[model samples]
Target: MKNSSRRRVRPASIASLRRVHSHGGTNNQKQRSLSTGRIGFFALLFVALYWVKLGFGGSLSTSSKAANSLGSSAPRRNRAHLSYDAEEQVAKHKLLPEEAQIIRTARSLSPVTYDKVAMSFFVMYGRFLLPFYERRPDMKVLNIGLGCEEDISARLLRKLLPKANLWEAEERVTCVGSEIEGLHSLTGDQGDVQVLDSWIEKSGGMFDVIIDDGKRHHNCQVLTSFEKLWPQLTPGGLYFFEDLHLGKSDDHRSYSTPACDGSSFVFSDHIKNWLDDIIYQGGYNSKKWELHYVFCQAGGCAVAKEPPGTIYNKPPSPNQFDKKQMLPGEYHFVTTAETFDPVTDKVTTHSFFTMYGRFLLPYYQRKPRMKMLEIGLGCDMNYGPGASVSLWKNLFPSAELWEAEYDGECVEKAVKEGKLDGLNPLVGDQGNNATLDSWIEKSGGQFDVVIDDGGHHNCQIKASFDKLWPQLLPGGLYFIEDISGKSKPEHLIDCVWPILCTHDLHHSGQVEGL
Candidate 1:
């Protein structure tokens, strides 16, 4: 059967089988292809595993570092040395112990170290009024409302005019002994205008310096004091009334009753009467006494002088009495724009929503040629026309400026324009580390005035004061606007009192604590 099968297999079929298995090529090619596929698969698996491990490990390490970093507290700026330097500068002024004591007391009352409004008034008055008294040794100074003797005004007066006698009036009679020395107190019915008149009459003739720091009985005080004190004032003397807002109160009838005496009237109506009389008749009819209204935030002061040619005789000229002169290179102007934009070549003026600008101008103008540094440059044009470099060129014509700003673009634009010549427009945040120091260093540490208008935050205001106070010139002025919003008299007593007291400067008995 095997022989028969072999015989049946054709020669052609045997030849094809031999040819198919010629060199074992098909089996080798198949084996090689399978091996290549296995190698590729293993390589891909290894790469995938390695990638997963690396990604997971990296994520864990990153998270751990982030947690550690976040857990740490930020370091505080080292201001100890700066504070010491400030203390030393104050010491150089060698302020008296009594003055220093008042300042300390004021500072202890609040967290802030300075009172911008009171301080501004004190400095300005000291600059202008003190000199007048200094030139005349026998000027009788009367402080009307002696709420508390621990103030800058009282201290400054004592220092500036050591020979001039000071008389202070209080609502209640208390011990005459205080830091101010010879403190005489008086008591009267509430809003009694006669009490002031009685005191003035008893003290003989008028005074050289009459300050109305009395109670806020606007109508009574105005009527009683205007008739009595104006005639008593020495020619060219000044009369300042505190708390003018009392005049605008609606309760005019409440100020005086039959039992309380007829000391009250419509205070606002009286002021309006005076204003109207001035407009229509070219002057008010206070028996020939010329009335000039001096408005301030704390209050308004009225100055009444007999006719220029009256028997009392006015000073050479109202301007002559004012020794204010424009500083070289100092100029000022009032523009409708709040800020100048170089790119658009436009001036954007801030709307007058309040009387801050109006009051600020007179205060600044009183100084004449003081060097000034304003933080809120365009918000309020308190410095007047020649206040900036552009306008100052025409006004002062020779003042220098060093302006630091947080907006780089604004600073760059201001510099590119000719509006700010000789002004160093420093670009950086006022709160940034070393930024204030850099500006101070660049400015050569000379400034007569410093206005904090940049950041109104309490911390920023305090920090700015801490940094800038040392740079201020002795007897120079520093203005911090918008303080009426959050600032109380106590805050200024705390921060500024210490520094001021250290220099033997004190408040004018205006504020209570200091």
Candidate 2:
């Protein structure tokens, strides 16, 4: 708001940019036709589907500033030949040193956009990084693996960006890295997949830069986790994947075994699988992560994500959400303390989990007498009592708390402990299709909120979703906690999260974790 002048564009340039963006382009791809021997019908269908998805996803030709993507069919360096010498490229680009540095590394690359004019694809980290880098602190960062004792990158970032605000909540930066023990002790948490995921989930929001060098061998897990982490990151964030060449040749992890010629990722390839799964794909993730630039220098790769716009990166409000109303039950509910205490009704929940409570409280509070379904009831009866049953009982005194617990004894225990007031419990295997269907049938398939705090396993999570999501009412919320891999909440069929985040500048309803 301080300087609207900076955003101003000349009318002619605006029109030109729009024209360039609107132009549809077909990539000059090598494999225009698949080499299907005799039967080409299926192959034709496959080709048609591929193009259709591309059209849905967007193409380099028509994408905003996409003429420079590695996959673009732009006629600049490729104005014809798929090769470029430094001098020739310099002459062709009439470039600066920084621009020349990019050209040098991008010469032999394919499936990338090429528009030296827009500098879209195959870009260097240093070029785009500093331009967008802030000196202030509070920028949360996650650097995996970099296994350096000195933490040279973190130190260098500190020096490049101004540090006058690191101490203030609005100014400080928090960078957490985790890795295996090496000659240099990494300051990060140990590079365990689930542990890192927990840390990311606990961080409660996305990072500005996520550098993953966690594994030298098998990187499939790392990339898989990135799916969850990337959504957490602010739009236009930078992501780095160290040692991309390992995917091409490293046998320790069998990263990739197919021929290394210019082509797409073959099956079972880690790095390529990552690219294939995310980029050029259609989904909320793809819509958010347009490739700004990429560089494969010294066998390592650094990529910049396209700006997601100001909307996705809105910061949490200055005033915290009032938790007094959503209290003691909220505490015992979150902590999993088997017994609920009415005397300590004024218990305070931690800010970390309260973020979830903030957005969730408003959902159920509207209807005091609402139907709440929670899958994966914690604590077995032979051992202990459950949390959600008691929490919901106290939190929503007038509403009914529906639970889907897998064990018979747990339900029996709850019945004995006098914990069954307003609590409707279902005892069945959460992972079983029959059980889920039976539960839906019994409940008449209606719930105001569906919370999956149950089996965090991928298959079980998805199975519960497939069966139970349909039961949730419109404008309802479905939450999956402790999820480490791909769980596309937005991609869920017919599930609409009406208020993902409120526009109330002071009170944003940020969905804490997926």
Candidate 3:
């Protein structure tokens, strides 16, 4: 516990786990707080924008002098003297060398906060946005909420990344099709995903940078934008959520869903919970979604999407799982299908290697003598005994594998027929805690990998995970497949979510991907 990097779960009490609820205020009190919050929020925004507009030191006319005042440590640029070509480029709204210098200077300044209000989103610009644009010059950007007539942040973005296409969405902005310089305008409610999707379709590409500055008071709007648009963002893209200060002053009340205590939904608390759930559901262990980097400040938060493996230039691993091509595991799976028909017999291909070949390959390769435990042995009449065990043996020839099945007669039959030769078998009910404990004891108290290809019932799965997951070695994998067959809603929301949430709570909401 002292070293946060090491995660060890105590499985005994996992069943009785509970989520601590966050409480807020009544509707009228919340509305009053929101009003006060909004006023302060805009005041800070005005100050930040006004500071940038005045060129940091004060007057826009003396911008070059202001840039020089930042000290010689700042990037050198001649802002006042511009060549004929440079002036024309400036008139065209292209990023000039001088403008880029000023933008960098603005972002590098120390963050300024007052009364717990943090206003400098430029910190994120320097940390994430700048490097990204530098890498992809013609990047597409989506900026929601065009504040005031000037819209300073959008304007700065356009000036900084001149070649980049900038899309601005605001409910009040009337020009939907109008394009000024590189900035495209789309007028609509920021909460509406369809409105943004239409613009994305028209643009013929996804965005590299997305900033949500609109609808600061609504958590549901933020959630909707993230869920619908995150997939639309290019991998390695940056997404920024600004003005989190509203959550502090507005008592974190959401306009839509009520909090668990019957008050309005707590925006800050709930969004974090949702994000933690996202990390658990699509973590590094899974093949689909990946969150590469997550950083949060008092004012805002930023999430970066990790690029896919296929995008890498490296050659594919021979053991990599590909449904299109027959992998070693897949080949063994098909060859072993004579015991049971995959289609007509209606037996799911519950082979451990077939189901988790991609994830298990690297671990198996690293430790050829790795120990593995599988909760179910596919002992039904349709499946035939030890089918998965056979596939696992073929794929992981050197692995010490153990298959736990409820039917003792099935294990006896497989052993008698030489189907489970050189395999460790534990015959018992998977739902019993004592049975799970005994299995752990018999097959060594630790494992590099544990798979639940078992009963597919909620009770059995929960029992196995609760007992085995804690016993899994550090950096080990615990895979649960065919969960859709029979997991109860209550079990997931109560037991699974809490366990995952607890494991992640120690991790500070960040799941580092492989």
Candidate that scores best on lDDT: 3
Candidate 1 lDDT:
0.39
TM-score of each: 0.38, 0.33, 0.42
Compose the digit string of candidate 3's lDDT tens values, residues 86-181.
234334433223433444443333321111111334445544565566556788888877653445556566666788988887777553443357
- lDDT on C-alpha atoms for all candidate structures: 0.39, 0.41, 0.49
RMSD of each: 36.2, 21.3, 19.5
Compare the candidates by TM-score and give the number of the best one. 3
Residue lDDT tens for model 1, 301-342: 334333233221211211121112111101011221122211
Q: What's the C-alpha lDDT at position 255 in model 3?
A: 46
Q: Give the TM-score of candidate 2.
A: 0.33
Number of the candidate with higher lDDT, 1 or 2: 2
TM-score sort, best first? 3, 1, 2
> For candidate 3, what is the lDDT?
0.49
Residue 156, model 2: Cα distance from true site in angstroms: 36
Give one digit per residue, the lDDT tens place, for model 2 in 36-89: 221111112111212211111113223222321223232233343224344653
**lDDT, residue 422, candidate 3:** 70
Deviation in angstroms for 234 in model 2?
13
Model 2: residues with Cα > 4 Å off, grouped in runs: 1-355, 381-383, 485-514
RMSD, model 1, all Cα superposed?
Answer: 36.2
- Per-model clash counts, in order, read 42, 20, 0
What lDDT score goes with residue 426 in model 3? 90
